[model samples]
Target: MDRQFEAGPRVAAVICAAGAGSRAGRAEPKQFREIGGEAMLTSAVRLFLDHPRVGHLNVVIGAGQRARYDAAVAGFSDPRLGAPSIGGATRQASVRAGLAALDAEAPDIVLVHDAARPFASTGLIDRAIEAALRDGGAVPAAPVTDTICVAAADGSRGETFDRAALRALQTPQAFRYADLVAAHARAEAEGRDDFTDDGALYAWAGGRVALFEGEARNIKLTTQDQFDDDLLRRAGRAFLAQGDVRTGSGFDVHAFGPGDHVMLGGVRVPHAFGLMGHSDADVALHALTDAVLGALGDGDIGAHFPPSDAAWKGADSAQFLADACRRVREAGGAVAHLDLTVIGESPKVGPHREAIRARIAEIAGVAIGRVGVKATTTESLGFAGRREGLAALASATIRLPFRDEDGL
Candidate 1:
């Protein structure tokens, strides 16, 4: 029985990645292959998981692929992502398995997508969901540019198709959940599993599938040549040009106070006395955060988080660094590297260098290799050398899209 489409239906997505992808000439499945330094499956799943309209999500993986699937989605956790479903022999069976897995959620609408097509934008997903809610079923398609012809057994053209009337289909095909479930069930009952895509399967079951515009960049990675570096650059997954690189430096100092330990780079180190400041006095993190802001051409840390505010009293300075990194990302940039030098006569940073580096990397969402932590002594010449306080100097290197006004 077909259920009627309603307003604001609960939308779910099924990422089908069970095929062997032998045509792509890869040892592993193409979906598990890397694109822009990330698994194609990961790229595809991230899109749907990030979309506000997508409610529940699931990925259908081939058998004996649990390890690969785990590796692909490592560090990715969201309430919307459900358990991975093991797929069957054929693509049709795999999608059926995925749909069956989602049956427990009982979504009102479902989008069946190919994991190899990672460039499906949020706007495309929105169009799919909207068309499904309004038309019961829909597929995103672009008009065919090349003239197509039906060839005979000997490869001679038997019929020619008007290019204007032809369309190249792309996933994710959307459908009313119950209606699609029923359609797949009918096909299974009739021993028909040859349908190329969900849209074709639904149409075979007498479901009228609608069409919406699809992006030219929303292409499927079916051939080995499609995995070119140019494609990654087009997807914004590649590193920016060197001309966009920028560097900024920052320095901070704090006086000795009456406390047992001090926070430095999000790590607590035992000391004779803590540094005095409105916050926890993590001078290392403060300098690094300021350095990031400086690279972004933003104001210093004090301007963003004033010490005059009581709300920041004893606040963890890691939050400050995290917020600064967030701003860099929001400004369409990435933190390339961070270097910090701590100067003090006591509470030696040598023992905590690795720990501090890891913590800073975690806060900045970069690799530990990108973070450098070191210690230096003032030889008892300055306040830091006299054990009166601690000081930190930081340098941050960032990459951003270059602006024409910079006159590179």
Candidate 2:
């Protein structure tokens, strides 16, 4: 160790998942595909995000992968998670890209792991960080169990190699930040991109390499069968048992107030009068927010953004819906779908249905297809029929964890 290790060294986690994973034989890319009822990349990212030693996480992904990546990481809120960086053609290039993403605030240590391997435990993470501090560069490796043999070009055994000297490497490889960065730079300059892992790059750069114990069960998912196994194990967890299918409904009405436009599903539409309330009074979003709260057994919008608070005056209703979505995610659940109906005589919704759906999807962090919006009048029977006020009815379907006592 050339430099004295910091007593509290800041460690960053880098997840390399840029590969297309064609070998997995799945319709979607392996990382984005579900393993434990969640995206494989999401599970992998969460493991480190939950680790106390990791101060930051930078996930490297391929081009055009941002949308799905955002969906995978939507629920977690942590300052340690950085924006996704675009990766290059190869694994080494992708890792370099991730490292470059952290150049502005390089931590004392970095743990680079593959996204395909979702089972790296917290204990392993601690070991890697400790090993990096003590050994300069260290990788987790499992001892070889099978007999080893050197093969000839034509598939003939040339000679038997010693099994005692063999070990299979795994990720969560830890390295001193500056040393790893410099080694990668050297590899790039030398046009030596053949190294498969960072440890090899470190060794090629004439840096000392150390090995730490690795898990045999921390296997990477390379095929669909492995993915199925992952999901099976995930199902075995008590928290993942099926039961909670909650549906919540919300209704909101705002009388015609003097304004030039009104907000609906985060989109603004010209109207003779705007909805009046503590916030922008986006009736559709307010209804949807309440519906989400109802599904969560949480209180309505007023309880969250009380009208008594002056800060909420003239606030954008999208914030309320976003807050509701965040709550749902934090509770280890998701809003499966949203259906909204607009009850009004003016400011027709037909012209802006697609726009409104897209806006709601954006605010709720859900797919546009999952959002349904419709418009209908009260047939000239009540206040809505007389065009005195506008009302919205919304329903939210959410999936929540089933507790032992709350079984169906």
Candidate 3:
């Protein structure tokens, strides 16, 4: 008899273990501290290794803790797990280093998690990966159920804040590999180091960050009291070990008809004639929009924002693309990954790729790492060779909740 089988998505796990954990008052980093008969790092690594969607793993450890983390994780080894790399002084720096250590070949997605969050559930990781693959940047987060406060430094009460609008962020934040690399490069070049987490970095780099409801049990073990095996087990109770993955493709074209400027992927390219259309007619944005819409099973750009409607006349194509992404989210589907290619002859895509990716991420409501925008030429073969027009292609993946849950 034949057997039935199901496959999960492929994702690379990047575990950040470089924090000193001074607040925990431990000689060893909190990630390396013993928890439930094993080092915290061991438990954390095991979570990803055992996860069905996890295809590759890389650990970023403090320079001195490399050997310790290696030894701790040795017994749980698998081909998916890569060797540990020495990390930098800051969390962002450590992430950059960890990303650099990724195998030369790319994976479908990359999950950047903190080893300190030992209680992170496999379900949460799967959900995050699903969201990242669908929405561009998916992060595990819990809504703030309690009343919030804006307090003074001395602990004196100040203004009470609205909890409804607040969310407590957590991790195993996942991104598409190309988007993450580009965001890191932009941040590093801009000399920014203030990001508290990878998601923040993505947001700072103009990438959209979508929030997924996180399990209360999936807490980061920042202090001794936060480390409880029973709590972790309880948190994993509602978690399912399964995951899903899908891919979609997008294509767009704009002819050089008449205008002073050409818009490609939301960036203005100086030219004699612009792509003529109802909107700004950016081929890149249209392709990406179609890709995202396709992943969500939502109809294409024309279906959502019709050219027949004058409201979109000469409107920024970037916003139109973004609105399409918003509709996808409202429908309970999340964008996980996106890859885009721009084909043009005159206005070079290489010089504007990063900016274009950033714009697309912003419009699609995803982190920069979840969006990939590249450029190429047809070697002057078709109308593009005569500088007559530009074209673009894009692909996207999305995750939808099993039953249309409200928060996730």
Candidate 4:
């Protein structure tokens, strides 16, 4: 409809998340890897999802990563979130792909952002928008804090560049949508895809560019160390700020049945017999799920995924745990800790304790250290001691907001 800067301009965000993250040394792309309980790319895309100014959201990802990308963002749904677009060989190509995807609506303003920079605040987005409105294109930039040098090939001392005049470019680089698309198209035609970012491409195409204040903490996740600490996100500064602490306990049991393997704690463990239930019967996960739901004042597993329903027949128990975690988030809470105990006489849990913990963390979307797994026997006292069945007990500690109606 050609809504170019119309009354209440339509804003679109192009998130470039195609990088393989070779520097981070991870097998999966850094964008899809979990960072602070969520994928880095998802964390970045969510900021614009519910924004009033952002009418459309497009994300570019690497080829053959659709399933991986979908899994990372499966928990988030918003009207502004658009379908995924496959990226090209380079970052510039990826941004252009996202912009092309955004052409259907013809938004007035476009913000080209990196999915690696999850910390880009809403205030920064506003600043970029303001600058782009004033200038033809705008990029958020911070003053070069470190002295840079143009060194020679053999480590010889060379000309030193003045740090005061240099600026470190950041993303969510805002621009007139039409102009930015044209610039990218021109670069592609001219075989000038060498530019590292859209700002450089715009400048190379003789477009006027303005620099706005950039956040010092909004660092892109390139190296492993940066993703390791993640202090800002791990600390839960954005949410989980209240003092309403709560706890809950859960227990689940399933008798041994006919199968070669059993699903326990989201991990496939080998055994002569499997657990019998409507679902895959991940006893550990079921107990943990109930623990989380109980902590949130929600119903237990049977109430949610009932055995009467055929849909839950052989259904993966991971989904149950995922749903419980989502409810915690919906209730304005986060899981602080999870303690699980596995009771059985055979098929030792010690051999797979770490793997079980890792799977639980992945399913709960929490850190591995936050999950504790232990195994014990009832000393020949009950069904577990008789090797008739296995049991799991779980405890969950969570933090939620204080509501006066709840009366603590």
Best-matching candidate per TM-score: 1
Off by over 4 Å in 4: 1-6, 229-408
lDDT winner between 1 and 4, please give it.
1
How do all models score by TM-score? 0.60, 0.56, 0.54, 0.57
> For all candidates, what are the clash counts?
0, 0, 16, 0
Show where candidate 1 strays beyond 4 Å.
1-6, 155-159, 228-239, 242-407
Which 10-residue span in candidate 2 carries the lowest summed lDDT?
234-243
Expressed as tens digits, the lDDT of each residue in 310-392 for candidate 4 is 99999999999989998988887888899999998967998888768767776776656578999999998899999999999
Question: Which lDDT value does model 4 have at 172?
Answer: 86
Alpha-carbon local distance difference test for all models: 0.88, 0.87, 0.77, 0.85
Over 96-202, each residue of candidate 3 has an lDDT whose tens digit, in order, gives: 98899885747667899888877676557757876787777778878787887778999888899888777889888978777888899999999997677999888
Candidate 3 global TM-score = 0.54
| Model 2 lDDT per residue over 40-85, tens place | 8988888777565688999999998899899999988888899999
Tell me how far candidate 4 lies from the true structure as C-alpha RMSD in angstroms.
18.5
Give the range where candidate 4 is weakest over 10 consecutive residues by summed lDDT.
Answer: 1-10
| Worst window of 10 by summed lDDT in candidate 1 | 234-243
On a 0 to 100 scale, what is the lDDT of residue 301 in model 3?
90
lDDT preference between candidates 2 and 4, better one: 2
Error of 4 at 109 (Å): 0.5
